[model samples]
Target: MADNATSNRKRCSLNAFISHAANTTDVVPEFPARNGPQRLVAAATKQPKRRQKVILEPGHSALDWARLKSSGKDLRGVPQLGRYTLTEIKEHRTENDAWTALNGKVYNMTSYVKFHPGGVKDVMRIAGRDGTKLFMLTHSWVNFEFMLDACLVGFLVPE
Candidate 1:
């Protein structure tokens, strides 16, 4: 349902193939290198060996989470979005009803438990607490705002 101009990917070929000819001819990159072509391969030594992620269950992938978020489901456990105090958020620390404050915004993380790559227990470590510091210390590169936008309950309020 997206326009060709707005789409990030280019549609060059009507036929999909795996041969070298198909890749070299059909796959036309949007940005061509100024200094001829560059190799797509990367050095093995440059690749990272490990990360904090664990194997996610079927249908719990990051892409699955993105789809679920766009499904119009109310992931937030609360009846409506409202400023929540620490005590109020603390009451929702259970696995079935978890909440956390990050960067002053409160997000209902109950729906995100299975989608969390760090495992359920790791996410529960900050349940009912402000996890900005811990989240920064662990995975600062993650954009929580965009990831958990659909699960946004409200803003964190002073207790």
Candidate 2:
């Protein structure tokens, strides 16, 4: 009878130890509340952060472009003249070199670089650039004053 009691006590102790170890070491609870709201704040109250415009460098590598091309994605859309791939734009420089825009426009800002509102240096970095597969020139010229905005106007120049 004593032997039986001792064996039963040992079994109960082993089971208790296993349960305690599981509760202590386990990271996730066995069951979590299913119907709780995922997000606490209302969506409308959150203001989305605006994307900063990229100040392009001449001969800058188009990492995003290369990735898309490697993935077998279609490289459609208009060109961005001042914007270019690092490899493609590296060939052009000096007075005669130029980069083409999406709508077939051309901007030779090398000489006019100084005249840029953002200063000539910024324009030169992106001018004579190439390999830009996508650009925005769809808006009406009257909607945004060209002369007032140099970045916008640089792409607006006709070929």
Candidate 3:
């Protein structure tokens, strides 16, 4: 009965060692002989692939501005919308006809007023006025030139 108790204790100790090793390592240890020791072999692990960063040049214009340039008589001799006075811009103040000046450029934002992410009130607050300061203060990172290309009315006439 003493030999049986010793054999049971040895088996329990071997099981505890194998459990600890399997939990700590990636591979499971194999025991060829039931009464023998445990041998652990590590399993191969695949490392994650790293991604390379792409750098773009400064002042990169994604769109071709040359294509949008007016050439024919469709412009009614205006030749690229010319320039607009503050008084002319102020004429479109209501929600039905909203216009805004930003960075010396005029933009007819009537259609975009309701669709503004910041809300119509925010857009209306600067209607028919120089919104360059307010625009930069709130959303300096926004690419207005590319996003509002179709909404552009003209450049502001120099004072």
Candidate 4:
């Protein structure tokens, strides 16, 4: 009976030590944003637009394929996970939430609307933020004219 009491106390002490260690190391901490009081207050007050989900089907659309050879049009060079129209983007603006980091920085390359060599559809497969890296890596013929056009459009967008 005396040994049992000693064993219970030892067990409780061991449990306490384990709980303390686990709380310190097992948790990853998140940092709060550091901003000036005015900025923080403004940010707190600002109401973000309630976004809705935008769904793009897994495969390329008929419109996407058609735009491939439509030459002499400007298809902003953007990342292509799937094809989406500007109208569709507005309707389902929430999809932009999934791509916040890529937004403003990336453009969708709609080869169908623009003139492209190696076929516009082929380029559409790789239309994200890393256009220069992708272009140089994939050996796609560089078109400064199209790139410049895309840059002009990208610059005009409000951040």
Candidate achieving the largest TM-score: 1
lDDT of 4: 0.43
Every model's TM-score = 0.66, 0.25, 0.49, 0.25
Q: Which residue pairs clash in candidate 1?
A: none
- For candidate 4, which ten residues in a row score worst on lDDT? 92-101
List the candidate 3 regions with Cα displacement exceeding 4 Å.
Answer: 1-80
Q: Highest lDDT: which candidate?
A: 1
Candidate 4 lDDT by residue in tens digits, 1-159 = 999999999999999999998777564534443565766787779696674433444344545544442444544434333443333333322222111112223343333223334444444444433344555555556444444333233321332
Error of 2 at 14 (Å): 79
User: Candidates 1 and 4: which is better by TM-score?
Assistant: 1
Between prediction 2 and prediction 3, which has the larger TM-score? 3
lDDT of 4 at 4: 100
Clashing pairs in 2: 58-125, 59-86, 60-86, 78-102, 79-102, 113-120
TM-score, predicted candidate 2 vs. hidden true structure: 0.25
Off by over 4 Å in 2: 1-90, 94-102, 131-159
**Comparing candidate 2 with candidate 3, which one achieves the higher lDDT?**
3
Superposition error at 8 for model 2 (Å): 90
How far does residue 110 in candidate 1 sit from its true spot (Å)?
0.3
Model 3, span 1-159: residue lDDT tens: 999999999999999999998788575555554444432222234556664433333322233222332322131222465588888888888888888888888887775665555556766987888888999987899887766666777888855
Q: Write the per-residue lDDT of candidate 1 for residues 19-43, one digit (tens) a residue.
A: 4565675656555454434424332
- Give stretches of model 4 more than 4 Å off: 1-108, 111-114, 139-141, 145-151, 155-159
